[model samples]
Target: MGVTKPFPASVPLSSRAYIDRMDAGLTSVAGAQEIISMISSRRIVTKLILGHNELSDNGCIVLFKFLGSAIGRKYQITEISLNSNSIGNRGLLAISDYLQGNTVLKELFLQDNNFSEDPEVFITFIRALNASHLEVLSLTTNRNLSDPFAETFLPILETPHLRELHLSAIGLTPQSGSPLVAYISSPRCRLQTLKCNGNSLGFRAVKSIIRAIERHNFSLLTVELHANHLVGPVSSDNTSEEDGDEETGGPASPDAWKASETQIRRVLFRNSHLKRETEKEAIRLFRYARPLLLCSSKHANAPAPSTSTRCTDCSCSEIPSPNAPEPEPDTPASNRPPVEGIFPFHALPTELQLYTLSFLAPSLSPAQRSRIYNFASSPSTLPRLGLCLPSFSSNSRNTCVLDPASMPFGLNANTMSPGGGCAGGKCAGSKNSVLCHKEKQRGEWLAVVGCSAYDPYREGEGEGVGEAGILPETGGAV
Candidate 1:
């Protein structure tokens, strides 16, 4: 029995402790207990590396038991490495139990351990990992994990948090390749790096893997398949009709393998480009959609308008100024009706809202844009009309004529202005009518109806038109 050295006091409490292969004697159970006790005492230790120390099942049990204890739970250890430690079924079961409730641990490296001694223990450990917060798991060089590995571990591919997986040098055969192909081809696969080197994968299996990677997977960055049985004659028993040339039952040509590899490289390169583009597009979309999201969130949280107090009048005579103070509601603010047009404005789907905003973004000024956003976000009961265009009839002379009934008030041909500037006669003196600057330059009539309150027949209004009147030449002789 080697004497165990005391853990260095000079090491900071928060720093990772690398005690693997240090000759500090962690091979025996007593040595493992001492080190674990030391680690448990320092609650700040976040990473414990003890690979290649030959910590057999006995020693690992002591370490894992300490990890599962109430006192061990206090340590902020996010990572633990115990590779080549000679750990067996008991130690794995202990680690599996520890992992079930552990949320802080993100990485666990148990490569080259004695997991093959009892395949059931390996399966149990993997199942426990599905519930844990582990992001990176490396279980390489644990031989004889052939078909069972595929059956037990394929479901773990759906785990959202797992990003990198290393299962190289495992005793995986061609039979284990199809399941791997299926899992990697799935949309739920989030693995970024996959290393499966030094396995007994044949040409068909490697080809299938390449095909899946090229066709379905865009997230995998690195796929290592070195030292595998990629070249050589494939057996008909191992092949399916999907191989296209399975009837021939011969080795895949060198050109075919080379072409597959080239396609893989091209596809991976494309994935990289697509990933960058996707990130850029996401950021751009978020920037553009932030206002809409905020508006939606505010609307969602805002009190539902009381139907009893809802204003039936949806028309707004005038656009309210952004700075204008909202009038006090007859009922409480919670019971107050939403502002005019707000219901329809917010009724649009989020995508449509984004589309509308993007379409109007180029034309709207900063102040105007801000006012629009404020109107969407604010719960004010101010009446405001959304932007709309009025329909008008045009003559062969390129003159615009307004419909009499379409006007806010009654109109006759005599009341129509000789100058074809606005649809409802000359709007030069009308406060509610605004002339289109662009149309005015071209000597054409175009009127933007600001409000529906402009009545020509009012008491203080100008002279009324008679019934027996002819439309003006500029008014298109209506």
Candidate 2:
């Protein structure tokens, strides 16, 4: 056996120590132990850099113990850099326990470590994150962050003071979409920079993030999505499908994805103060995804009507008094008779009208749908029609018109109402499968009745309808 040397004397402690790149000389736990002894004596080192030393968990644990001790608690460390040191979970757990009581630490760099060896230990470290004052946490390549670990960690990643989150190349997949989106879209999220480069987050994950950014008004400065599986060269027209080459692992018909991407780009690039490099990266990430095409004069806004006056002869109105005379030739169009067989739906009370329409909606015959479409679409009928239209909810995303003639995605009334049986304007469920039928119809009822003629996507409108009752360019049943 080789002769052992006496322990090295501890150097006088200062506010900072940069012991990086000393792997060739001091390559043992003895170095970490000396540093720990100095710290345990409350030597007042506020910054420590032990990077590139290859000091494995054994050496790191010495530092961890020093960090957790009562004297170590007296010494406030504001920054620590243990990158590329091969520190594993055991050392990380010790560090986590130390962090619980240490309040001054604001930055940590644990890149290229072995934290992924046991995700539970990393989770324990994350749990301690709530107690620490960390502003910058970089875990660039702990490849063990698979679906399970991500799910556990994402809920805890909502630290409001965390300004920059570097999660690039951590083995994230599409399964991380929902939780990630929920966190990014949350109002409490104050993260300004989110780096998610070099992961397998496909179109689904990208699309969800894009939608969340727009729908939830995310304020992130920049989101790095470089070198992932979001296969692009997206199509020109909104209708063209994405190429589904198995080699690239891309799916077909990426219109929705393209739309969402374009919207994200718009939001990110809207601010004029962003740096040129950030704008360039935004462009590069969404090069294939086109910007939103502006509508022409054909989609110009129309002023809504000033007043809504119900027609006397419309079927929705209660029977007129016998003494009421017919309208003179000079009567305004709003007082004229409605189209034949079309109910004066606007004449009824709002709630009663909605209930009546919902009752009639399930089994609308082709002829009835046509008549309803004609009356609702007419500019002359819009003044009165505006009175009864559903006030659209901002939260609803699945708005679709109930017209049988213009149903999208090849849908039709036959498919919508398989076994129609609304004989007396009431959609009473049959006895055999009443529960199942009612459950199925419940979704459709909400979809149809909750839709509004003023929806942003309605064919004739520029964007959204206001209270002015301006008729859209395209009119159809709600």
Candidate 3:
């Protein structure tokens, strides 16, 4: 049968679509085809939910054919749910083939399905997972998968994009524990959620898992161990360490199990705190960086004056005047090429640039940091207010220029105290002291109130206020 036509225009395009249970007679191959066709037509649909439909292998095969097609490639779907659909290896392999070339899909839910019937199918799926962008996967209650399944799935944990995994009640045994612990302990493991509850894991295996979580798996936030063989009471007569090795389907003692649980929780708490702080820092940095990097729409689209060299609302003037000598034809902002005034530093990924700045800012010297701040700040802030005061020493007549950049607390009346630059009260005692030189000359004040300063020539004192400590060439602007 032919695929169904697209939905009518009367229906608004939505980002998410739900077709649960397939009560609309969409449980067969024709139904799958119709669903795929409808979703493909709506380019805005990013999430597709079709769970509990029992669309077995036949329907799944048909669905995947559309997903792997060129028309499917044009769709923006990033999430797909096929849970409890009675899908088997053939259907899963087909999905795997689609994933090999797909980059948009980040979530796939296939819980309570009939998978692992053929081990090679899972092997191929793992290979496809390595190439895919899928981040969250659910395979819960697929009890057919055994220890070998865990061995084969170890590589999926290494997939950087796969963050959350649900493998609960998959018939895993004690043999699968070593491989899981080893993988979790690896520094490259980035899996954040690992749910393996309802498994047959023993005491030693649980202990190993806890130890690995405590030592290496800081990214993991939720590790469901409920309903697993984890804890059991111990007899007071068996006090030796060997008693813990018996592995009677539970921990050697209830106390030991509680201790392990407590330790894991502490580690997870620390990790959670660190993650929150990191996110807060990232947000703070982005707040500061966004205005400097992004061009406002008003400035981005403003037309340039024919006679003027720049726009008043934009930083286009900051670019070399000669580079844009002629006025170009007007175009939409979206179609325009990148503005020359925008720094290439903004081209880096947002997270990477923010992190780089966070690490780099602390290591920079005060002067270097000031220069960076000036660069990032508005053009009006680039001009520092110069303070010129008459020399207070009896021997000199030149003025002292205080560059706020050199001052520890910045240039202000409070920081211009006698103890700052004047040594031995020479400036306070001299007739030429700021207190006595209250005259104004050519829009310049010879002295500032509430401060007795300006003995910039004292040796071993007022070192930075001397002639040699005047504003550097770069800081001499205004």
Candidate 4:
């Protein structure tokens, strides 16, 4: 027994040497805590890698307490990676407080630490971090969130100079996080990189964010959102009813809202000249003129979806209009998802879509509503946005499938309908007046257009030539 003696590895001299390569295999929060005491004894330890360990808030606190002390001040610890841990809002809250106090520490890696994405945690912590000089914050795999913060971490929005923000796999639906949508539209944010993949930010959010980035002058380059269900995983048979063609690509419903801030950002960014540009600005100004209600809770629960937009088989042949851009291999459809901006469009309740299209009518904002209105209303001056206009499918050139309703501007179905008219203005009388009826009647006019122009998606094929009428509410729930 007297033959051997072991040197304490935690002693500052040896610990400092080992700290440089400190790969402590502390497994759980408990293990991490037990080793904290040993590590705390060292005076010069700077970097710590507790990755692949299950360190929770309690365990991290033990380390944070010491780090927050005079010992922590002595060391210029800059990096911390807490990978593989269930550190939710509570843990993030603790870290946020610690971060506010410790400005020396920069580059915090909270990856795999299940941080609570509640709007409060994000907002409060970010606001509290007014003293934080830290940059490069990563919160991956911490899904559980609601509302605004669920899809996007609002705290990062506050960081004026912070460079990178990674929020991959944060639990959310394509429709979630409108608050952040509003935030991104704000001209104040100064973020460079935003990486959100493996989460459901939806096609609409993706397009909205991208367009906003390009419009707002954010120094951003990378955008990722995959693996999460953007297009509802539906079988050929199990299709959504909203996809039906009843509303002529979903009428512009009352709930439809224009991405006004985004439009304003676009106008501010792009030096517009054409009718489309002026009309776009004018319509956006009209929408923004009316203020929106401030959203409080991040996951403040809202009413569930009353209906969803489903695909309708309208005009399976010929391009709906010449406005849609043809998909090319070299196009952004290359690295970017083809259906990226599509989720919000699909998420558009059938009724909302209709209303959007109606206001999209060839009215005061005809040039602006080109994508939403009757083809005639759209200005010849405004060149088509590649996406808004329909395209012939690659699968079969002769058999063209058009997403004619895929317009950048929103069209609420409620306002666009002509009561019983089809050609952009009010229907004079007989069912012939309604576009729906014309399609059903197989009139020479609709026949001339092949229903592609009137029933772009072919939503009402089965409804049989009924007069233009309000679609009967199909008791569906989201």
Candidate 1: stretches off by over 4 Å = 1-24, 117-119, 155-157, 230-233, 237-241, 245-256, 302-351, 354-478
1 versus 3: better TM-score goes to? 1
Error in Å for residue 430 of model 4: 76
lDDT of 1 at 329: 34
CA shift of 468, model 1, Å = 73
Q: 1-478 in candidate 3: lDDT tens per residue? A: 9999987767342323433333354676976877877775553567778887767899999888887788777776788888778888989988999888567998999888888656688788988887776889888899988778887778454455677888899887767877888887774456678898898775567667877776566567778765656333422222122334554543456766576678778877866765554334433433464354333222344453233233232223233324444324364334446668885554555446544665533322233222233333322222232232323432122323333444556456345643333332333324443432212221011011100111112131221111111222122111
lDDT against the true structure, each candidate: 0.59, 0.52, 0.57, 0.45
Instruction: Give the range where candidate 2 is weakest over 10 consecutive residues by summed lDDT.
Output: 289-298
Best by TM-score: 1
Question: If candidate 4 were superposed on the true structure by all CA atoms, what would the RMSD be?
Answer: 27.6
The better-scoring model by TM-score among 3 and 4 is: 3
In terms of TM-score, how similar is model 2 to the real structure? 0.46
All candidates in order of TM-score, best leading: 1, 3, 2, 4
The weakest ten consecutive residues by lDDT in model 1 span 445-454
Q: What is candidate 1's lDDT per residue for 270-381, written digit by digit as tens?
A: 7676655433333333345445545464534466333222212232134333554433433333344568856554456655665576444432223323333433343332
> What lDDT score is found at residue 390 in candidate 1?
23
Once model 3 is optimally superposed onto the true structure by TM-score, how far is the C-alpha of residue 130 displaced, in angstroms?
1.1
Clash count in backbone of candidate 4: 51
